[model samples]
Target: MFCFLIDIITYMHSNTFHIIIGPTIVKSIYSGELTYDSDQFFRTGNTNSYYYQAIDIIVNITGNYTVKSNSTIDTFGYLYIYSFNKTKLSINQVTKNDDKSGSLQFTLISALQSGVRYIVIVTTYSPDVRGPFSITVSGPATVGFHVNTAATKPSSSVTTTTRTTTTTTRTTTTTTRTTTTTTRTTTTTSKASTTSTTST
Candidate 1:
């Protein structure tokens, strides 16, 4: 004769996927999921427990979809989800596991929306060292925020030009009287003329 003992924790979300929140052992929990023991701790103290929603999604024709779950100072780490932004979406933080072992999952669901994009960023808090928040995205993909700053306009358009010019005019006159030169009838005359050129 022989006796054996094992444990497993499986959690499911409506309209979403399933996850093993605790130890994943291949055993038949034929004791048949012992009644939810109120005194039973999922892990330990505030450092080791989490709460999750039974339902995973709600969809709107168009808009932003956001989901979030935070962790205690003890169990802060990367946040995980099923898939990101079937439409525009945002994912918040991670919640702790009861035993100082696991983390919580937050889910946001939405239909495809026009002119909108989605992304999920996974970041860590104190005591838990991880890389910069991992980002997941779809449709106009990005690893960062998208606000479409380039599409904005400041004001209407108008053009202007300027021109300047200067002009100068000069006048002069010369008069000669010759009443005495007619008496002699033999007057000799020589006239010298001077010329000047002006440029503009």
Candidate 2:
């Protein structure tokens, strides 16, 4: 005699799973009009300023970014990426570290909406030589569960007596001298991390 069986599972969870896996956003340096220099910063104004790329997001996101200096100027910078539709909403704004030779990298610890476009960049003030900046964001990762049936053995053959035993041991106390305990836990997990960019 032969037996065949199948197991199907359905799960419900937050669509935002990027918090797992790696950061949804992998950081990278801007290619042009940006570098780690302390002298050429003021070319635009006394407080060296410049905007890098625009990030288009489907939802309102909250993450941190950093602006750093690579020279020994011991200087700091600020990040203010405002939204086009909401002038008062600063998509990203914060101060980075004190490393004279490291670029700024900030993190945003908040939630995002359904549809919003954002700007991500940095502007700093120091002696006058600058070029190079990078931004990174955290998001959810995607994962899936599957059932495999690829084998040479007959698929309908029962390997042993199969049992889905959910054993919850509970302790029972006897009239005057004994105790018992029970354990209960159920887990079904999923994924995160996805990124896309557009001009804003």
Candidate 3:
């Protein structure tokens, strides 16, 4: 009798599941203009004067952001946290940049946080420069830009009321006149000169 051989077979199966996480990027652009009416500030240790515009930054996500400017004027950028004081040019400053992508534009990279208020100042490298400037901010989420309205003074309005009474036998005459006076101060300065003039 022939011996029977026993054979054993085994089978195995394997499976894998993978998840990839990537960063989210969002871009926002703001178009603004700088004129003689724009806010002015002097850089530290420099007698040169500059006209600037302060923009309030509000973010929805916390991440690194790239803030850039596109303008014909030589642009200078400053990033600040909490508040931005025009007089105190260096206080609370997070970062600053002069030029990065050429065209005399400035690019500033900063780590921004959510729930925190930030300020971005766009200025010129040269003194008394004014023009149109566009800003682009790219981060994890879109951001909101609010121009600092405190730089512009609010106009006040004055109202006057007049009353007149007349009798049957007599007549009354009344004259009402309103006069408005506006006073402005003009100043002239050079790159190396700082002179102010007030006109009354």
Candidate 4:
């Protein structure tokens, strides 16, 4: 039995521009800074004019989760998992690095469900590129169960009994028993990979 719970919420960089940088709850390693008027309200559509800044993570324990971002320039990483009274916008993972060498990274591996609440968005794909960024979350704190058992025995057994008596005396006895039962089922399948890296 193993259980590990992590909750981290931090936001401190204020000049009043709609502060809400984090729904904030991360397992480990969170550092922040994204300039050029930080809040853009998370809208991705209509021919690219980038604007995104969001952070909110709450994953109590389910299994297989990783959200990563490292930046110093050209950055873009977005991973979202909602649906806890926030109207449902579940699991959207995005990363950018379209032929610009390096320095923007995003990695995500899903399969999370145990008190679920996730929203991580770090911007600057293009639209006033910023500086200093670091976000990290590693996997497997819990959510694993495995049990297997198999048994079979009884190779040989034989018994015979008969009785007979003479002159108005008679006895009869016969017994035979054999039993076997077997059932088996097994299934396994797993695959999780989401990674984006750029270096310049």
lDDT of 3 at 7: 33
Give the candidates in order of lDDT, highest first: 3, 4, 2, 1
Model 2's alpha-carbon lDDT is 0.31
User: Can you write out model 1's per-residue Cα lDDT over 67-171, one digit (the tens) per residue?
Assistant: 333333222222224433212223432222222333532333333344433322322233223221111222211112322122222212111222222222223
List the lowest-lDDT window of 10 residues for candidate 1: 25-34
* Candidate 2, 31-141: lDDT as tens digits: 222333212223233443432222232233343422222323233433233342122223354322334344433333333333333333333343343444333333331
TM-score for each prediction?
0.17, 0.30, 0.64, 0.22
lDDT of 3 by residue, 1-200 (tens): 11223333333422232323344556788878877787777864475468888888888888898998989889999999999888787789999989886989999898899999999999888888888888888877788888884553232212222223321222233445578999999999767778999999
Query: What is candidate 3's local distance difference test score?
Result: 0.75
Question: Cα-based RMSD of the predictions, in order?
Answer: 33.4, 33.2, 45.9, 41.3
Q: After superposition, how far is residue 88 of candidate 1 from its true place, in Å?
A: 19
TM-score of 3: 0.64
Put down candidate 4 lDDT per residue, 6-78, tens digits, no spaces.
3333343212122122122334555666655555432344433454456665666776666666666666665
- Superior candidate under TM-score, 3 versus 4: 3
Among the numbered candidates, top TM-score falls to: 3
For candidate 2, what is the TM-score?
0.30
Model 2 lowest lDDT segment of ten: 151-160
